[model samples]
Target: MSSEETLKRLALETLEQDADRIVQLIRVQMDNLTMPQCPVYEEVLDTQMFGLSKEIHFAVRLGLIDREHGRSILADLEKQVSDVHEAYYEHREQLKKANK
Candidate 1:
């Protein structure tokens, strides 16, 4: 493929790979996030995930990536974010009940 096509392909692949790593991070954090009342990890994860989604949007707008791939990246990250948020809440509730 031409240079432009090669760039686009590489960009899409990088996006998917990075997003997958972030999801894995979320899963690992969820597995051990039950430490003493600490919000740092959750806050950082949310911020990082949001920033990545925004980067995907900007990459598409700048013509670095195609719209379809951009949408897919955002959608995948959004779903993972939702799942992580739900798990965090459930764990928080469990902790509260335990403490009570």
Candidate 2:
């Protein structure tokens, strides 16, 4: 496979792994009844997304992926993250209803 192909594959694999991690995080927060405004929860989200984005840029600088490809990769991951957030908010609402 070409370097481009290799890079793409790696990016996908990494993204899948990270997405799973994010899901696990969301699950744990829900289990603990944590809110989005929780500082620790916010920190984790910021750290995870920021770290992944920086990694993508580093890969671009190394020529493993082009700028556009990097953006696409990050976009896919961001969408997954967004989905997790939606689930979290839904879970939070359910918790609120249960409490009331």
> Considering every candidate listed, which one attains the maximal lDDT?
1
Which regions in candidate 2 have their CA more than 4 angstroms from the true location? 2-8, 95-100
What is the TM-score of each predicted model, taking all chains together? 0.67, 0.68
RMSD to truth, every model? 3.9, 2.8
lDDT on C-alpha atoms for all candidate structures? 0.78, 0.75
What does candidate 2's lDDT look like per residue over 9-97, in tens digits? 78657755765676677767766768777898889888987877787787778766678877876677668767767887887788799
Sequence-dependent TM-score of model 2? 0.68
lDDT tens readout by residue for model 1, 1-100 = 8998888788788888878888887777678765423588768677777878887887788799878878878787879867876878888899899999
